[model samples]
Target: MNGHEQGNSRAAPSRLRIVVDTDMGVDDAAAVAWLLSQRERPVELAGVAAVWGNTGVDAAAVNVVALLRALGREQVPVVMGEAAPSSGPMSPIGSLVHGADGMWGRAAGTIATCPKDLVAFYRAVAAADTTLLALGPLTNLTRVAALAPDVLRRFARIVVLGGAWRHGSITPVSETNFWHDPEAADRVLAERLPIVLVTRDAHRAFALTHDDLAALATAGSPAARYLAAPMRAYAQVTGRFGEPLNFPDVVAAVLAVEPAAATVRRSALVRVVTGTHGLVRGQSVMGFADNERLAMIEGGAALARLVEQALAEPTLHLGRALAAILAREPDNAEVVLAVDAARVRRSFLCALTREART
Candidate 1:
């Protein structure tokens, strides 16, 4: 059922309005389709902004449109965002997991020719109580923060499907999203906006086996059908590595709509490694101690410069900012450290298979 048809009977006083910023990979498509299938719930898909990560900018937009059309959600607007990262060219590493087309070579639908103005669109959406669901690189959101910090602060919160605390998926110390654009990730974290970080530490607990795909195929909803091919393809690819499919984006989406699904959460200071150029680049330096150590190490030169500037000026603003950075006094983000895997999996399946209540 479409979003309008499913939630028509009841007055959803606490309906969540979400603007999804994605790169339209297989997992991203799964997340979007799952969100669309929540007909019985009070979640609204405000809009989708496609950025360059899992695919090219145009391809990402096309993929989102295709998924929406498959689920009878063509009414939702789709816009293209940044074509590449601010610091360098687009990375093709996502192709290994998502395939060359970003949707397991199954993306198909009419392309939307809407103008690509992510900042403007986001600004407009900010007028409402909206949560930004970021399922890809932080480039687009960082652009918004750079061009319009006031507008960026207007959103209720941002649910980021990135980062890794224990280990990384793409690299030893870096997650794919942050690895793709560490500069942008660093800038976003520095903004200290209300952010819910769904990292690898949490998503790794929610894995999807072949059995889940079989169940989804049997269920046969439009969302399920749309998800079947890509998920299966994803499983096949990861199977070679003796690993099950993990839906990081889907996990983040679930947490966004149902915050209670998260079993373990911690408020912490997070810093994306951007100053250094090595294996540690894009690493999510979490906690006060780690962040402080990282700053003292990789950022020693920058810190020295900051100290010099502060010493020269002795201004309250610079001194306070320096103190906050050095001490890591207040937590900036709420990190999702763990989730109820069984409950998340069950809820995901039910959303796909169960009929909307009248």
Candidate 2:
């Protein structure tokens, strides 16, 4: 049943309105799942703009549709975003870390995203004065800001799951998402918006232990089951390497949902290495003073349990209705319009890539 039809379990109008933009991977999928699981509980979980990181931007949106369906949260549509970075070397989707697809092998078949007009849809839903939870590269936000800087800057807050001052994701000094497109990161970071950065330290801080999954073996909820299989798969990998399953994006997600949970370790203007040269190429550094809040959470077992509980809550989301509509009505005007949009997006990406490098 669509979220619209079945109705959300928690409908408090006072809840905060939030949007999540992601790059689907095992971790990102895990984050998206956590976000939906909290739908209408404390936040509206408004729109999701699926952009690039672990997979192609559109590919992430396809997985988002399937995931939303799995959790039953179709009322909040997933809009496909920038296929490539606005201004840096694209990262190849390596390691089946999330599986061959973006999720637990559920992203194989063809999937359709919200009616073809991604730009319009993204603009329509990512309204001014709303909070934004960015869980991927800064590519999509850069593109949007390029279209309307004022609108982008108007966001009440922008919580990023990127950056690694204390560590790295791709290199010893660079985080994967920021490293993937440092130019875009530079542009987005230069904005006037109040930014909250969930550092890599937060990832290490808010992680899952083998015992956590052991406990989930009995939790009865779609979110728990959805997280269980893939998490177990993840645990198997980390177990062999003797590492914990960290949920950095969830830290950012929780910050978006509950701003009070975060402790801003540093508040400063940030800068990222944009020159295509060394180990510090994507490293994001901070100036001694500013409005951006670099966040970290230090809640031992409590934080872990918070994420576990979130996953255990069911989310109401949509059918593959968009797929069905496209299947039955292949000639729909939206499809035609979407083709044009793709060309525009491609042109923008190409131009930005060239200009940023120069």
Candidate 3:
């Protein structure tokens, strides 16, 4: 969630040099495929990095390659990014939202493979303008910055899709990605670059309904067919059994290709609250700094349709589709409130920490 943002324009890029960092959950699969299929605004992969969330980076790396191959983008290198070891023991979160293998109790075998010299590939892109798409924790980016801060600075900007201001999906005020590694979050935000943040308050607004999934089941594109299974499986896992898969990682992908897809953005100064060890730990507190500022994308229905349209037509110029999708935006202005019980689960975490100390 820690990155930088630039101008909000719909003018498509001829090509984008990018480093995609992911936790490789179901929405992550969707985001990766969408990035590959972006027709007008093609994304050129510098590298794809996996972090330890949603799943371990080891498994995340495997899934990254699998999806890239599904879209016939197997040439992109997959890097198991460097991150400090977890400071505390915690149960894994991917299995709950994205199933055990990170896909439907998946019956199919993967045809993906990773290269051994991923770091070499990363160093090769040092001089170019790179945009980082963070679909998970900031650990990988922080680690990369330490190795070559200038290489990170060369990034034109970053488009991030996680975090929250007042409500915490992980704790009282922490979102999942930021909560998983607040130290990394703090470090990455400290770089002070222009960043576009799609936080939890805005992300949760893009919901999927039964109609959206129905469209995917019949869209007949390779992307549609490939992504439909896991999306449906995720719906079932989240007990939205018949509802649309509401994960919003794809929102970030669309914004990457077309920033105009989001109509509202508030610039705010921000800070990350670390080491509180209770409800406040890992929270990204906003409106605290005067000079440090980032644009927070607002949540709405245009986002939902943009995602659906992207799935329906993977290579469609999102800039063109925005006219129609943005028209339907008003209907999607308010998303039905859904409760995330993750905080309830973390409440028991304090007991474990106490036991560890005792």
Candidate 4:
């Protein structure tokens, strides 16, 4: 059963309270826009926390505010999150995919800010039926786990947009978000919080082709018009690499609000490689012994080769030891093994074409 099904036998809330912790990349902006456009769904975007990933935290916050302004939802507060990863300097790979200004330099300029405490904000929101949608590195969530474990535990569920069961985007075995801050990802997963991991395997299936962008550009809605150019720019960059434009964050957001979007999910013991220097530094190793479907998703021969390669590297010895310990732990997360790609694309496009609800 998914997290929602496993919840206490009580009447479900009319609306889901969501606080998005994002890096505000192009996809992240699109994800937030989709959330705000859920006029018929029971979704309430409580707030947004911008972190360092696609760009610096300041630029991310600016992007959030600017997007909110364009959507007429400026009242939804945006706060700056961790300025860097947990244990190292911020990664520069984000700019290669998202451009230097994160939003293709479209959403620039400053906005008035306040000294909002992330931990304090979580503490307050945790009391409600809140779901945390993490669309970037887990640095800010890890900080919450460290400063206030109780508060972190109080969330109804956390939908994370990272990890890869078969292949990763950043490296051979590492997804971008976890690769940016593996240490933080490791800690958050090990904390045993109620987490639903939306991996690349599911999101990549919903990639946007050139035709999809063409449809959006002519859709004539404000949200679609605002997003079409940046999304097309993003597609251009990734196209050169022979990859389609994937919106992993938007996939996670949809699954968070609409669980049926996930056609296949499994409970598993998951671990992240936290080693500072290794070929698989941020690799997500999932133990799928109990689930035959999961085992099939990650072929045994392939997994063995990955392990063999890791063992061959002396720099990964400590990470291997850490992974061994986490393997013994109970299942910590429900992994989204598959999703309804057509349904997700339709929902995303429909949201973009609709007017934002007040």
Question: On residues 1-358, what C-alpha lDDT tens digit does candidate 1 reach at each position?
Answer: 7898887866565878999999999989888878877754677888999999998888898898888888888888788899999786787988887888798878765565856888888887874488889999999999999898988788888999888899788778788899999999978988989999998889988887677778888787888887888888888888888876788898999998888899989877788888456788789988746546447444878877776777798564675666667565466789998999877787777888783311
Locate the minimum summed-lDDT window of 10 residues in model 3. Answer: 349-358
- Taking the tens digit of each residue's C-alpha lDDT, what string does model 3 give over 1-358? 2233345434555777777888888888877766665454676877787777777666677788777776677778787664333356433766787877676544246644555343464576544477777888877767766666766666676777666865567766778887887777777776665467777765655566555666666665666677788888788776644433456687776666666566556655455676647877778766422212212222345466666878898798766655443333122111111223232112111121211110
Q: Is candidate 1 or candidate 2 better by TM-score?
A: 1
The CA lDDT of each predicted structure is 0.83, 0.63, 0.63, 0.83
What is the full ranking by TM-score, best candidate first?
Answer: 1, 4, 2, 3
lDDT of 2 by residue, 1-358 (tens): 7887668565454667788888877677666666665532456777888887777766778777777777778677677788787655556743445555556566567476456455575567666657888888888888777777776665677888777767776788788778888898878776646677776655555565565565554455555565667667766765676666765666666666655455444555466788686788889765432112211111246445544655675451112322332233121000000012222222222221221110
lDDT of 2: 0.63
Those runs of model 1 whose alpha carbons end farther than 4 Å from true positions after fitting are 1-13, 288-329, 355-358
Stretches of candidate 4 above 4 Å error? Answer: 1-13, 290-328, 354-358
TM-score between model 4 and native: 0.84
- True-structure Cα RMSD, model 4: 8.7
Where in model 2 is the C-alpha error above 4 Å? Answer: 1-13, 39-41, 87-89, 93-96, 115-118, 289-358
**TM-scores of all candidate predictions against the true structure:** 0.85, 0.72, 0.71, 0.84
What's the true lDDT of residue 119 in model 3?
47
Looking at model 2, residue 35 earns an lDDT score of 60
lDDT of 3: 0.63
Which of the two candidates, 2 or 4, achieves a greater TM-score against the reference? 4
Q: Write out the backbone clash pairs for model 3.
A: 4-194, 4-195, 5-194, 5-195
Task: Identify the superior model by lDDT, candidate 1 or candidate 2.
Answer: 1
